[model samples]
Target: MAAKRKSNKKTRKKKKQLIPPAFIVGGIFFVMVLLIILAVINIKVKNLEKDIKLEQSKFNYARQIEKDIKAIFYDLEIDKSFAKHELIKENKKILLKYYLKLNKNEVDTLFYNIGNLLKKEKFKISYFSENELSAENEFIKIVFKVSRFKKSANKTNKEMYLKNKNNNHRLSIIIDDCGNNINLAKKLASIPYPITMSVIPFLKYSKETVKIAKQHNKTVFLHLPMQPKTYPNTDPGKGAIFLNTPKSLIEIIIRKDVEDLGFIEGANNHMGSALTENREKMQQVLNALKKYTDTFIDSHTSTKTVAYNVCKSLKMKCGMNRKFIDNVDDKNYIREKLYEVLSLFEKYNTIIIIGHLKENTIQVLKEELPHLQQKGIKITNIKEVLN
Candidate 1:
C-alpha cells in the first residue's frame, strides 16, 4: 500500500507542473490582446485629433478672410470721396464697377490686395486687363463679377452697356525676317494698322527695310539671328550669335546688329532653336538688347526655351509668340491661321502672332486686316501687348 501511494503522489506532482505552464500561456495571451487594443485606441485618438485640428485651421482661415474684407471696406469708406462703387445687372449676372480717382499704382495695389485675399479664401479667379498702370492717366475703372458656386439665378432681359456689348479683343501681328525683301516690307507697312516688322540684321536690304517701316510709323524689331538646331545644314544667316560665342562677343554682335537695324523697338530670335535653349547665351543676348530695345519677343521655337524666363528674371518687357501665321506659306493656311488668332483672342483677350515675310502672308493680311475693324478687333502694338 505504501509503494502504490508513492507512485500516485509523483503523478500528481507532474500534473501540477503542467497546470502552471498553461496558466503562464494564458497570461501571455491576455497581455498581447490588451496591447493590441491599446494601440488601436491610440490610433483612433490621433486620427480624431488630426481631424479636429484641420477643422480648426479652416475656421481660423475663414475668420481671417472676414477680417480682411472688413478692413478693405473700412478703407474704401475712409476714401469714399475718391472712390465710388456701382452695381449693374446684365444678362442675369451681377457686375460690380469701381471708379476711383487714384493713380495707377494705388489702383493696382488695391486690386492686388483684394484678389490675393479672395484667392487665399479658395475662390476661383478669372482675371483680364485692357492696359497697364499709367500714373499720368486720369481716373481708372475696375469691373468684376463673383460667384460663390457654379450656380446661376433667374435670367432677365437687360440692355447691356455699349462697351460691354462689343468684345474688346486685341491682336498684335509681327512680320519676321523683314529685311530679306524691301518691297515686302513696304507692303507690310502700308497696311495702316500697327503691324510690327522684325527685320533681320546684316541682310542685304536691312537698313532700307527699317527706314520704310519707320516712315510708315510701324514698330521695328531686330530679328536677331542665333544658332539653330540644324547649324551647318541650315544657317541663321549673317551676324548670327552662337552658343559657343563668348559673352563679350555676344554682346558686341547684338549691339552691332541693333545698330545696323536702327529704330527698333524690340528684339526677337530669328531661328534660335539651339541658342534659345541655352540660358547663358540667351541672358547675354537679352542683356545686350536691354541697352537699345525696350522689349523682347521669345519666338519659343523649342520647348526647352529659357528666353522668356531669363527676360522675366531681368525685369525686361517680354512677350511670347502664340502661333506662326505663315509656316505653311499657303494663302489658305495663312487665312486659317489668322482665324485661329481670332479664336485665341476670344479666349485670351490678347494674342501675339508671328509670320515670315512671305507673299502669301502679305496677301492674306491685306485682305483680312480691313475686316478686323468691322469685327471690332483692335490691332494693337507689340509693346502694348507685352506683359
Candidate 2:
C-alpha cells in the first residue's frame, strides 16, 4: 500500500508541472488587451484617411474655382461693364478661402493670376497674409495703388479746357518810333491810354518828346538808332550802336542813350534791320541796358536777328509784334490789319501790334479802340501783357 501511494503522488506532481494556473490566466488577459488596442488603432487610421481625402477634395475645388475666375477675368478685360463681374469674382475668391481654405497649389496659381491681371489693368496689389486661410493655403487680398493715378487724372481733367480757351485772346497795343513828330506824338499820347513813345536819341525834340510823354502819363523809350542794311548813311544819331563800333563802345553808347532819355521805361529798335541781327552788337546793348532796369522790344525787321535770343539770355522782358498795323499807313488797310490783329489776339490770347504815329494809323486807332473795348476785347498795355 505504501508503494502505491508514492506512485500516485509522483503522477500528481507531473500533472502539476505540466499545467501552471498563473501563466494560463496571464496569457488570456494579454490576448484580450492586444485585440482591443488593435481595434482602436484601426479606427484612428481610417479616420485619418477620411480627413486627408476631404482636404484633397477641398483643394481640388479651390483650384477649379480659381481657374474659372481667372478665365472670366481675362475675358472681361478692363471696362466699365466688367466692374461688377470683377467684384463678384473677387468676393468668390474671398469666400473660398474663408470656408474651405484654399490649397497651396491653388493659392500659388491664384497669386500668379492676380499679379498678371493687375499688371494688365495698370494696378498694384497691396494686401497678402500667411494666415488668410484656415488650412495650409490662404487667399490673397489685392488693392490697387490708386493714389498716384488719382492725382494725375484730377489734374488732367482740370486742364482740359486750357487748350480751347488759349486760342482766342487779345492783349495791349504799342506804338514805336514817336520822335519824328512831337505834335503827332502828343496827340497819340493823349488817347486816354498809356501810349509808348520810342524817341530817337539826340534828335532835336527827343528830350521834349519824352518830357511831354511823361507829362501825359505816357511811357517813353529810346528808339536807339542801329545801323540799317540798305543805307550805311542811316544815322542812329549821336552815340549810336554801329556795326563797326567795339562791343564796349556799343555798351557805352547804349548806356548814354538810356541816360539821355531821362529815365525812360523801355526801348525799341529804329532802322536796326542790320544791327539787330548782329549777335555781338546785341550782347553789348543787352549788357548796357542791364543797369537801367528797362525792357526791350525787337521790331523784328530781320528774321536772322539774335535780338530775341539775346533778350532771353539777358533775362529781359521782350515783346514780338504780331503785325505791323501801319506799315504802309493806308487808313482802310490799317483798319483791316487792326481787325485782323484783334482776331489774332482772340485766337492766341495775346498780341503785340507795333504801329507808327502816322496820321492814318492814329485816326483809325481813335475810331476803333473805343469800339473794341465796348465789344469785350480789352486793349491792355504792352507791359501788362509782358507781365
The candidate that achieves the highest TM-score relative to the unseen native structure: 1
TM-scores for all predictions: 0.57, 0.54
| Lowest lDDT 10-residue stretch of candidate 1 | 132-141
How many clashes in each structure?
Answer: 0, 7
Per-residue accuracy of model 2 over 96-133 as CA lDDT, tens digit each? 32221333223322333343233333332233233221
Estimate, for each residue in 1-387, the C-alpha lDDT of model 1 and write its tens digit.
Answer: 999999999999988877677788999999999999999999999999997786566545444444554455453332656555564433323334555555322333344335434433445333333222111001112253221122124321111112233457778989888887888888888988899999998889999999998899998899998886545444678889998899899888887898887668888888776789888888888888899976999986654578999999899999888777654445775686576555454347777888878788999999998776677778889988888
